[model samples]
Target: MIDFCNVSKVFNTDLLKKDFHALKSVTFNIPEGKTIGFLGANGAGKTTSLKIAMDFIRPTSGEIKYNESLGKNKLEAFKNIGYLPERPFFYPHLTGLEFCHYMGALTDLSKAEIESQVNVWAIKFKIDFALNRHIKNYSKGMLQRIGFLATLLHNPKLIILDEPLAGLDPIGRKELKDIIVQLRDEGKTVFFSSHIISDVEEICDSVIFLKDGEVVFNGSVDQIMKDNIKPETRISYFDGDSLLTEVIPNNKKEEYLSKLLKDGKEIVSLQAEKPTLEEIFYNVKKN
Candidate 1:
């Protein structure tokens, strides 16, 4: 729902030190109703890009164009965006329900509307049982869950999550990922940043990879995986009550499979090896 066109950001420091280039002519599109993963390692400008998109930090050069669907003006558009920062601060003394109410009030939501949204989302997020408990008593995952519930209280069309999965346990990660997918199914545009490639690969329909303040790759996840498929195939077969596994070159796979079949070996399984997103990410960094 947003187009980042040739965006660049520079942080000027002391005269003795050089300016830091946080982003270098980065360009990408967050299409409507799609779950887009902003992938990058630490200090790779992922956060900078999101900040620019949110208008939290101005880009030194270039601009971000919001689709008219967001609103006619910037203020109206921003109202339609739900954002959760990487290190969100919450009132330690406020209970979860109270926190949600406070956030909803900022969004101009009425008390009744806030209460209704919280009732639905808190249950779905699995944090409803603890809504009356103090925030300081919540675990890391619980904090993240409450943060998300608060973000969605307004039902924004576009949800921008900065490192949403960071510091989450495996179960926490899975729960958040499932929520992201649910948002997609409900036709919400989600652009989330993360250094975790496996989590992104599992849930993102498409991904934008940033390396050193540059856009390295931006396209469909399936297409990228297909393009980076390994040039070998793995096979498993039962031979004399023993299972044998082998990896063969793509060119020799057919020949090898034929030989095994001709020899009466029971073929157990055949799989074409493919590079994981992590592998591809390392390769991108090396390049």
Candidate 2:
């Protein structure tokens, strides 16, 4: 688990020049064993928060604590964390297997352990056949898969993935989602950033929405949807071979239904359109 307490990051580090506040007193907690999505538009500080959490960059005015009982040593905590950046760089000359072995060594895994773990993840990601190929020859999807495999090779307790599904095809995305679900089932915590709202909706138990370098929302996805539910329900009916539709406030549904029946219009269908994550995201951003 991790906590960001009043965290703020200012780029340019100067008062005279135009300074950019990447994070504005952001505060949140990442609970254990939960898949959390960091959602934001460009320049919303999603990546900045993740970088601060990972200690890639120091926060300007706040503290990030990870499992306080584990002590204040960041490297000790990082040993249990696996991270994949948005655009992962790979060794061009190393084959996939060679790269995995190289990274696995950094985690202090034995050669046998590295090979076994790599094999398991390779099969899971369907990249077994390509492991012998050179990294420079990999396509975007293949590179992403290899990068993902490297991230999981050590089986870290917490996985931090930045845009894990970026550039992946539909199948690749589905495969990654399935793997993420498996990790969650196995009780591993997953924190990821994504531009794809639908994927976040499908995979994240909780989501954090950022706007203008601030936290706009942070809670369960279901609760956010419920809180932002649309106030109107739509009704469709037929009036002498002509179809007509009406949007009525939720409280007036019964009244409108009664009026439609009294008017002698044959009811075609009646349904309430649920608010989607995308709609809720835009609404939050607009506000």
Candidate 3:
């Protein structure tokens, strides 16, 4: 489990005394065996939060707790965590296989284990054929795959991916999304941050929305879907329909619900509406 306590991060510049609060008193817990999508804009605190949890950066003011029944060390919290940053910085001289092997060595994996894992994930990421080529020669999508393979070589329990599908073509994005879902099915706890709403809507068990360095929403997709409006028929009163006595006065409380359920018989839609993820996102921001 990971917890962010009263977390806040600020970056300052002297020119205008600009202080961008990346996170604002944010607190959330991710349980085991769950896949979560973190959503926010370009300058939002999504990266900051992930970095703090991964111990890549210190929070300006707050506490971060990493609890592992497996007794993973603080600095070694990364041992059980797999992370792929926005832009992976790898040695231009190293081949994809060489880089992954180096990462495995860094994690203290034995030669046999390293070789087996590297080959497996490389094939899965479609980088096995690119193994001998220098990383500098690999395309953007191929680099992303190599980065992903490098992260997963250690077989971590928790995966943190940043914009994993950022620059991929449509097919590449779909394949990557499928791989994410497959990872979760294998019981690996997954957490990813993405600006793409459609991707999140499809795979996330739950999401926490950040806006201006604050958590604006924390709930399941269903709650987000039905957040604002009640599930009832909308009535536009007709001139001859007795001006709709179905107002059901509040003083008579029991009668209100009864009248609503009984008399809300006819309704029309501006269109056959489905409160999609985009709609829910709008509701969160609007509220």
Candidate 4:
């Protein structure tokens, strides 16, 4: 678990460049065993916040507090946290299996342990056959899968992934999502940043939206949709040879439906318009 309290970060080390504030008093809490999505567009401080949380960069102000158990030593703390950057760097010459073993060693795992875990994850990810091939020969999706395998090699309690689903085909995205869900089922906390709202909607229990270096929204997806999206119900009916449709406020659906039936209209279909996360995200951004 992690907490960001009024965190702010500014980049101005270069005298020739203007100061850029990547984060401005962004505050959020990541509870354990939950999938939390950091939703934001490009340059919205998602990566900046993650970097600050991992202590890769120092914040201009505020504090990031980790669980007491993971706060004592930096190296020890990282042992329970797995991180996959937006663009992962792999040893191009190394085979997938060798890379996994190398990453496992960095995490202080024994050879036998790494081999066992690699076998299990390779099969789960359906990349067992590609493990012997050099990483340079793998496709983008294959590389992404290998990155995920490396991240999970240590069995970290919290997994931090930046744009994990980006650049993958639909099937590849589905596979990665399934793996994330499995992590949740196994009680591992997942904190990932993504611009793709649909992916977050599918997996995240809670979401934090950022815009222009500010925290615009932080709450459950359902609550956000209910608060930001207008309620509407649509009805379609057939009148003789003509088709008619009516859209009404959700609160007045029952009253309007009765009126339609009383008017001898043959109702063909009735449906409530549920707002998608994409709609909700855009609505929030516009405001």
lDDT of each: 0.93, 0.90, 0.80, 0.91
Q: What lDDT tens digits, residue by residue, belong to model 1 across residues 85-164?
A: 99676899999999999999999999999999999999888999999999999988888899999999999999999999
Candidate ranking (TM-score, best to worst): 1, 4, 2, 3
- Per-residue CA lDDT of model 3 for 1-287, tens digit only, reads 67778899987856687777778999887778888888887788898898888778888999888877424778577788888998676889999888988989988898899899987887788888989999989888998999998889889888889888887999888888988999999998888998888899899888888887898877787677766443433233333354442322334545544554576633222222246786677666677
Query: Please, what are the lDDT tens digits per residue for candidate 2 over residues 12-108?
Result: 9677889888899999999999999999997899888999999989999999999953336888787788899887769989999999999899988
Candidate 3: where is the Cα deviation over 4 Å?
A: 70-72, 228-272
TM-score of each: 0.96, 0.88, 0.82, 0.91
> Looking at model 2, which ten-residue stretch has the lowest summed lDDT?
68-77
Q: How close is candidate 2 to the true structure, as a TM-score?
A: 0.88
- Counting only residues 3 or more apart in sequence or on different chains, how many pairs clash (N, Cα, C under 3 Å) in candidate 3? 0
Model 3, global lDDT: 0.80
